[model samples]
Target: MSGKKEFGTTADGKQASLYTIRRGTCEADLTDFGASLVAFRTEDRDGRLTDVVLGYDDVRGYEEGDASMGGSVGRNANRIDGASFSLNGKTFCLDRNEGENNLHSGWNRYEKRIWKTEGVSADGTSITFSLYSPDGDQGFPGNLVISVTYSFPEEGALQLLWRAQADQDTVCNPTNHSYFNLNGQGSGTDICGHQVQIFAEQFIPVRKGGIPTGEQAEVEGTPFDFRAPKEIGADIERADEQLQLTGGYDHNYVLAEKQDRMRRAAVVFAPKTGLRMEVITDEPGLQFYTGNFLKKQKGKAGAVYDFRSGFAMETQYFPNAVNLPQFAQPVLRAGGAFESATVYRFSRVLP
Candidate 1:
């Protein structure tokens, strides 16, 4: 089933609309503002439908909120060292939203903009939102056209497909920043107890400002290790420099080399709800972030979200990849097209 409704009005007096798509008992709510995932509900082990992702009630909350929440990050996702990068021997400076580094493409975030509904599946199980960014927008080259498609192709899977084309050479790396709380967004419980397993042997370490140090450190014997299923809070509090730098797990894991097919990135299981979420993607990096900086903000249904209340599994290229020659470049050449897909498969873990 699928339908649309008026969410709210944007600051510019533009109307924002919400689109709902459902299969069986699983439902997903998305909005035209920022092409974001507003809400996602699925059946837990108790056979109760539960909203598992965190976000505000309307478009106003998303527009005013600093946290990306369930926003579709774009142009260049993640930080770029020194808030600048050179392409084709030309240096371009960007908005330094995070100290001297740029985070999520700075204040002109894609999440805050209104996107056009390109198409909605006839069966009402999928919707695509598109946006156009002129040249030098956010200090990046190219007149970029991007689209994000949200689809429910199966009973317990939500798939996201990102496609973009640039008229000129530019940096383009997009990802969905949805904070997931499998125990239900309104449960008011932190995700520390969730069992997580990341299929990565190494992770990128960051400096004081959360910019990658241009080196991939082994996760073995370290607090960053999650090669096996373990409670998220197990080593999060250990006396480790990496953990101390970012205040918690906010680094990117080095996924396997580029593959023609989708690869399993990570798995998260909420014991209390017996809900398991498996992340699959073709990207070469997976950013596992615990909501360490979440302030006590009012969320949907009078829920107050605090630190570590939710987590995000962002699939994309390495952070600062444009500046790091050792990492895979995320440059989209002139007139070139880019595409990537990420899927979140949900299931109930039987006791």
Candidate 2:
């Protein structure tokens, strides 16, 4: 069954609520504000329930945190070079929030807004949240209607499906920005010891300011290689150029050029808790970030989240795809619709 509770009001006094769906041993907590994932709990190997996704106890923490936490990001997730892009012979300039580029759709990103509850499943297995964006919002040329659904039907899995349609041709790429700590949120430690494996052979290299340099570098000999399971901190501290550029593991790994089919993207193992999370998605790229810049911020249950405490695997189209012709284009036509799905499977590693 599912339950709903009053989350809180937004800065503009818009009312918000949290919907929770439970199936077997898994439970997902989602809020209408930003269509964010508030918490995801799974039974550990010790038979203890643990909330694995990092988040706050209320809506105020999300508004005050630097990281997006568990919110949905869109209007072109990630960065756009120089905060500008050309489409149909017209150059569109976006609001620059990160240096000379646009990061996660700038200051007025979708994560800062409140979404409406669109629908719920008859069996209480899913909840859909939606928002409408006017044409020229965030300097993008389209009136877009977006919906994101969170579904929990099995004991150890949660699926996120995103859909968007526009009245005018525009850039549209959306992904969830949920920081994960399989050991559980507010656990007072980082994911440095978690072993991670990403099924990618090449990655998009970024220069200073976190903009892609247009080169698909091989991960053969660099610290970007995670082809096999390895501790997150093993090569994270290496004196590599890319590692230093982003201050940690913050780069986009290019999946094989597959079309419209869900594929395995990544797997993360938290040794201490014996929790394993497998990511599957139909997107073309995955942005792996090690939360390198996180500081001692307040979180759920009076938890002080410090640097490198959690990590994120954002599955979506490549960053700055609007400016790169060679990359997967994120442009949506007037009559076309965008649809993508990603799933996170949680299971306990038995001793």
| TM-score versus the correct structure, for each prediction | 0.99, 0.98
Residue-level lDDT for 60 in candidate 2 = 79
Clashing pairs in 1: none
Candidate 2 lDDT over 23-115, as tens digits, reads 888889999878999899999899999998888887777776779999999888999999999999999999989999999998888988888
Instruction: Give all candidate RMSDs, comma-separated.
Output: 0.8, 1.0
RMSD of 1: 0.8
Off by over 4 Å in 1: none
Residue 349 lDDT, candidate 2, scale 0-100: 95
- Estimate, for each residue in 1-351, the C-alpha lDDT of model 1 and write its tens digit: 589999999788899999998887888999999999999999999999999999999999999998999999988889999999999999999999999999999999999999999988988889999999999999999899999999988988999999999999999999999999999999999999999999999999998999999999999999988999999999999999999999899999999655356989999999999999999999999999999999897899899999999999999888999999889888999888899999999999877
